[model samples]
Target: MKNVMISLAVMGAFGLSMPAMATGLVAIPAAGFTGTAYTLCNTTGNFGSSTPTQPTTGANNTCATFPANEATSPVSGYTLIASTNRNAVIGGITVGAVSDRVWRNTAQTSCIFGARFTASNIDWDTATTGTQYFEVNDIARGGFGSASVNAGYYIQATNASPVYRIGRTFTSVQHRAYKYDTAANKLLLGTNYLDLPTANSVNTALTGEVTGIGPTVVASTTSATQDAIVNSNWIDFTIDVAYVDDDGGSNIVSAMTYVEAACDSSAVSGWVKTGAIRLRQTGQENTTLQEISIDGYAPPGSTVP
Candidate 1:
């Protein structure tokens, strides 16, 4: 009986489609449930090392108390307050309602300075039947998904343990933002976001058969950098693979197997590039060839700044 042989190869292709999702203007609260306000006074010494004293000696030094209703519920999304002076103003959310609790300096006027609210210490009442939602502002600071609701990006959180939701399906690239631990020091992406049900399924879908080789062969490349420009903080990756198979001998040999090239920014880490080319034997040493190239881009904002 003639030996029937099968050879399979798999490559990691970085290229994937990311369609723009609708986003909306909304306020997310800061990480800490509460915030404190401080007042700055004048000093006559060297401006660099000199410290300012409180406007008042001891008791009266503290400015007017912050408003009561000012401990804004998740309702008031983005609120702005005027400066009482270059210094004195409400210090906390206690005495009365103030428009904006957070303040910005004249230099930062063009910038929206708001708290990136997070529900760390506060217990998230997910069990409540009502609209169990929290609000945050200055979302551009730190948050997953886009600010626009229509943009399809939204914040999601999970406890330290796994929680299952039934009747929901997700694509391979969909992600959810969640707290990984009690400290809330870091935000994490769950593998569940990848939504891969079984490892074998991915293996089968990407596997290709080996066929032939070409006279022209090329080696892989590598690139690295520590400092990068803002919008340009992305790494492009490409990989090429070459292999051959022999049917009569029921054997296969890899001609070249390596990463083509990789680029990275100061943000994300542990990125690699890879590709594959397969050849199958038609007769003795004759073969058929198929080539596939894989590429991906890693942007800076994706990781810690």
Candidate 2:
């Protein structure tokens, strides 16, 4: 995935011409996706992070300018607000070419994030006793701790409790953004700007098999399927309120907390600027977690000296 990102960057650095790209729509899956008819536009291209300009739809959805590559990058009109890379061996799993990034649009109203785990041979077999978890966070400073509790907004998935969830930090609350409306059989959140029923399409671990959201896990390279190495390898996300019903309920139009903080007078915690990823590989100690940070860029709507 690093190679894919670098290649795209190189093409931009050169005078090479790329094809035209546009955004597409994404559906937020409700419990059984029973009565949820909401959808958000896919701001990033088909390559997700690699080609920011081309957001394709349906089959053969790669940007016309570049070949289909399972990588992530900021979409057109959006800036790379945060990015980080991880290359090492964790828990005997060779972690290579892994990147986590967050992108904010020009209006500062929305942000997109993506992570690619191109590392080979990451035996994520269901038969194993290991557990895997992934989460995207916006915090004041780099690294993870109590600060990430409700910095801005986040989406998390795992093989344990709170299987899948999303939240925003407008008020002081423990996991405020994640609330399951059992009676309605829908997900409730402080700021419903997060596209519900969100799924990690590129990564199998974050798919319905683990998070109970989005599409079924792609078939693994192995006959039995369930290998994260050969099947689910990358993940991407979008956080925006540009649609008709940003909150998924009330059908009332609204703005996202991150957008309000960056553009309006909305009061909340410190700016939801820093974006991070936390992962707990299967078989890792229950108390252990790995966090990656992308704190290099200044928050949108800020003055850079």
Candidate 3:
């Protein structure tokens, strides 16, 4: 919703009032635990190597997803949407760097399969003192591959060794009960056990597991609703992401240009050639500058020429 408004505001500012036929815009809000640096489910913690050891900041050999309200511990009550695919394949969002395997918990005792996490009330993250960054953790896997007490996930100090035991505030965006019957980008993928934060910049490497994305935006029906001037010949598209804070941290972004496709100038190129036209009316073959009216599209201040 906020991203759309920003796009429209840019148009109006430049005298591009929402095209008359521009009925509505779609927005994809990222609602879930983006990532809060938590501790690895380590046993030896010597960057714990595994028969199933979660080294200092790593993941494990299991994956699971759920609907909201299924409890984990510390925090609960989240309806965040997420998804999971088999064998390192993610959906929707762009994929990045990949690794064969990093240190993780494979130990039987430490590898409790079904675990979950939720949000935290603590001020672990602050503009100043910058510290603590892990996305989500499977708390049940804390004491992985055989070792001592399960201590980690929630911590008390800046980068202080992770709180390795239970009965502490762990964090995440959603849990089992929040799962809706239908969703896409809302879902999360990957072992994501004991995730570590990359650099502060938006584009940087972070995790050691395979992650994929589902579709961020919902689908629309063909020839669906449009505004007063629907120019079907060309689809006007605007995409944006939140760059900085707005009314409690939002993703309001600006412009980017289009890239030519790989099929440019080829037979299957998106642009149609003159020979492709099939006019039923006589003398139309030689005529140009014809205005096409798209179904359900009504462009502003535009009359069929």
Question: For model 2, what is the error of residue 243's alpha carbon versus the real structure, in angstroms, after optimal superposition?
Answer: 38
User: Against the hidden true structure, what lDDT does model 2 obtain?
Assistant: 0.25
Between prediction 1 and prediction 3, which has the larger lDDT? Answer: 3
* Reference-based TM-score of each model: 0.15, 0.29, 0.15
lDDT of 2 by residue, 114-228 (tens): 4433223243233546533222211112221111111111112111010111221110011112222231212232222232332222222222112222112111121122111
Worst 10 residues of 1 by lDDT: 1-10
Alpha carbon lDDT of residue 184, candidate 1? 26
TM-score of 2: 0.29
- For model 3, residues 1-305, the per-residue Cα lDDT tens digits are 23454654464355342211111112111110122122222222111011112212133211111112222221122111211111111122211111110111222111111111222222223442532111221111111111111121221112212212111111111111011123321222212222222112221111121221222322121111111121112111111111111111111211111110011112112221221111010000011111111111111221221
Of candidate 2, the 10-residue stretch with the lowest lDDT total is 251-260
**1 in model 2: Cα distance from truth in Å?**
27
Superposed on all Cα atoms, the candidates' RMSDs to the truth, in angstroms, are: 29.1, 18.2, 27.4
